[model samples]
Target: MFEGVDLEVPAGGLLVAHGPAGCGRTSLLLALAGRMRLSGGAIRVGGYVLPAAGRRVRATVAVARAAPAVALEGRLRVKEVMAERRLTGAGVTERRIREAFETVGIAPRGSDLVEDLGPLQALLLATALALAERPGALVVDDVDEGLPPDAHGSVWQALDRVRNSGPGPTVLAGCVRTPPPASGLVALSLPRRSLDRLPAETAAAREDTAT
Candidate 1:
């Protein structure tokens, strides 16, 4: 549950939701992506209001979960992932896929199996998939996890490119610490709260501040 949470991300701005482990960062991301139930308040993406009854927000928003435990069919090759997404109605083209891989600095080959890549590569591939959807807003949890400190800048630079590419997508990423310089990222910190106890007024105040 998130309390006192208020934030506004400008179109195409990179917003980082920074906090410690178990802080409501992931939950907040899930809520914004319309994957979790919110007991109160509003979530708006572009001009559409989320959590409205029967309103589908997933079509315009994309989320890449922290740790990105996405199950890839081990038999599928890297190119197949892009191909399958296109076949399934995602607007990804071969060129776009190639470009996304290049943006993330990955050399995606047709013969490379998903399971053969290390964790960082897998995360980058997942990000590429999300980009292929051409969402108006992108939510990524733990943008820097599992990556060596030296590699953070390159990864953030790629994300910066994605953000600046057009009226592109608004990015909301969660992290445990301050992000690197290239993220062009601003932050909103979620407060620590006890799950067993409800502090309604306190949460409300934080939300007030966030807005």
Candidate 2:
């Protein structure tokens, strides 16, 4: 659990929660997304109340989990997924969806089967869908998962490109490890564990400083 944790990200800013596994990074994202309740605290995200006003918040907030949620249905073509989303409820156009794909530097043909994409391409497609939603806030969990160091840099660059564009939403991501120095990301050096242990460690450090 976290205590006295304060986080602030300006509109369209990128907030990266970097920590080891089990450090409550994903939990914090859930809380901010209103999927989980905050025990006691005020939360204002995308102009909606958190924990309490979850449904309302969800409208303007979109979340894309790790590859587990990146399934694109093998039989359907790449653009078909985008079509399905628009048919269901998204008011976004094909051009807009294509633009999202372009923004991430992925160009899957409309007729391409979902199964054809490699792991990274699949991930990019999932991200493109999230961007298509055009939510006020976007949260992506486990960005660094399953990526080697070489590809990690490229992925971060792509994510950053999307994070700093026109009508950009507030972007938040959680990373378990790697990407040694997470520069250009707000809150990049998040601790590896819960803040429950922080106060005592901080106090001891202060005592040593005082001595």
Best by lDDT: 1
Clash number for each model: 5, 0
* Residues 123-194, model 2: lDDT tens digits: 677777777777666778788777666777777777776766567666777787644344445664566554
Give stretches of model 2 more than 4 Å off: 1-4, 66-77, 111-116, 178-184, 188-211
lDDT of 2: 0.65
Task: State the lDDT of candidate 1 residue by residue for 1-211, as single tens digits.
Answer: 6666656676777887787777777777776676766676677666556567314566666765544333346578987877886776356677777776776678867789987876678767877777766777777787777788887777677778777756557777877778765444567876566443212321110111100
- Tell me the TM-score of each prediction against the true structure: 0.81, 0.77
Q: Model 1: residues >4 Å from true position, as ranges? A: 53-55, 66-76, 181-184, 195-211
Q: lDDT of each prediction vs. the true structure?
A: 0.66, 0.65
Candidate 1: pairs in clash: 4-203, 4-206, 4-207, 5-207, 6-210
Model 1 residue 25 distance off true place after TM-score fit, in angstroms? 1.4
